[model samples]
Target: MLILVTNDDGVRSPGLRALALSLGEIGRVVVVAPDRNRSAIGHALTLDHPLRAEEIKPDVFAVDGTPTDCVNLGIHGLLSQRPDLVVSGINCGLNVGDDISYSGTVCAALEATLMGLPAFAISLDTSLFSHADLSVSTRFAKKLAVDIMEKGLPEETFLNINVPFGPCSGVELTTQGKRNYGESVVVKEDPRGRKYYWIGGTENGFEDLPGSDCNAVHRGYISVTPLRTNMTNDKTYAVMQQRSFACMGDID
Candidate 1:
């Protein structure tokens, strides 16, 4: 099977390298990732500007675009054959709850799913400089990837896997968790009297909602949450159909 690997932390990130090495033991691994870190870019694509893909090594390419662009290019243009699955990350930090909404890691997997392939986005909840042993995390990610290739993911669904900051006990299938960011952004001034902002210095608080990704990871387990490309709330659709706004078709 052909497996395409990528990450939001750039092509040279240790986590992405570790994941690629681990999955290489299973099948053909192709790595196409961003030339630089593109974290929190969500599911955006580079439609306005021309995307560039450069071959950095054998089966490894770097793209001057977002994570989504990497997967789209890999499957459509770069890879020698169509990949059976596309896997993103072993990212440097966790992507859960609201973070997934803004994560380029998840967006890479979303791109693969849109292209009709089973996909996964995996993350480790720690900084690279920390003494976090990535062996277990990468191994688990490989195992999950293998399982996905064997069992196959549902239509339009991609797995978002998040590992906690310690040794793992086991893995859990979970729902997207809730993250409450307490004073999330920091306001700073760039050069030339211009005010800028940075999203740093604070952590998002979470709770153990049963069967949630946050709870599983908090308990030192790997959290595997299946995500969909569509953001529609199915439960509220019927209610929305019943309500009517009367401001259409008449210009008075």
Candidate 2:
């Protein structure tokens, strides 16, 4: 079996290394990741500028692009053969709730799903320098990879896995949760007295929704949320179908 491993935390990330090493025990692992951290970049493709990939070492390539770009290049460009699975992360932090929409880690898996591949993004719910033992997450990743290869993911669906910081109780299949976003922009003055703004928000917690990814992680359980590439709201589509728009020949 061949596995493509990538992450938004860049090529040198310990989490990335740990993930690659752990999965290597199961199959041939090729790592194609961003040269620098590209967290929260979402599913952005570098079409405006040319992308560059450097083979830093055997089976490892670093691209000067987003996580999605790495997945694209890994599957279509770098590898000798198509990978059986694409696993993004063992990320530096958690990607849960509404934040998954803005997560490069999750989006990497999304990109693979778009290309008709089985994929999953796994994240550790901890700070970058927390020195958390990643054995649990890596072990689960390998197990999940085996399960995926055996059972196969549903058509057009991928998973987002978030492992808690410390001891893990078990695993929970969850839905995307809601976040309490607040006061995101921070205003500041530069050395020249010119105002500058920072775009990060203080962590404002999440909605107390049961059976949610955030809730599962909060209880020290690994959260696995299945995501689909199609964003169409079936209920909304049904509602809109009831409201008929008979087009008059011409608008005055």
Candidate 3:
């Protein structure tokens, strides 16, 4: 089996290396990842500028683009054969709650799902600057990859896996949780007296939503949330169908 491995963390990331090495024991692994950290980039495609990929080592390619671009290039341009699975991360930090919408790690898996491939993004619920050993997360990722390949993901659906630091209590299937985001922008003055702004915010915590990824991770369990590429709200669609907008006929 050919497995395509990629991450939002740069190609040299310890998490990425650990993931690729662990999964290599199961199948042929090809790594195509961003040359630099592109965290929280979402599902952005580099259409405005040309992308460049360099094979820094055998079976490893570093692309000067987002995690989504790496997946695209891996499946279409780099590998000779289609991969059986696409696994993003073993990311340094967690991608739970509303953060998945802004996560390049999760978006990489989403891109693969859009291309009709089985995929999952795995993250470690730890600080990005921490040098925690990734053996546990990598092992679980390998196991999960095998399971995904054997069982097959639901149609148009991928997964978001967040493994807590240290020993895990167990694994739990969860839903996307909600985050309580406060003012995230930080204003500052540069040495030149010009104002500059930073985007990230202090962690404000999550909603008390049980059976959610955030909750599961907080309880020392690996959180596995099945995510779908289809963004349509079925309940809203059903409600809109019953409401007749006869006023629309008055448009000039």
RMSD of each: 1.8, 1.4, 1.2
TM-score of each model, paired residue for residue? 0.93, 0.96, 0.97
Name the runs in model 2 displaced over 4 angstroms.
247-252
Q: Rate the local accuracy (lDDT) of all candidates.
A: 0.89, 0.93, 0.93
* Collision pairs in model 3: none
Tens digit of per-residue lDDT, candidate 1, span 32-111: 99999998899889999888898899988999999998988898889878999898988888998888989999989998
Clashes of each: 0, 0, 0
Compute the lDDT for candidate 1. 0.89
The digit string of per-residue lDDT tens for model 3 on 65-181 reads 999999999999999999999999988889999999999999999999999999999999777636586877988999999998899989999999999987799999999999877
Given candidate 1, what's the lDDT at residue 170? 88
For model 2 the TM-score comes to: 0.96
Off by over 4 Å in 3: none
State model 3's lDDT: 0.93
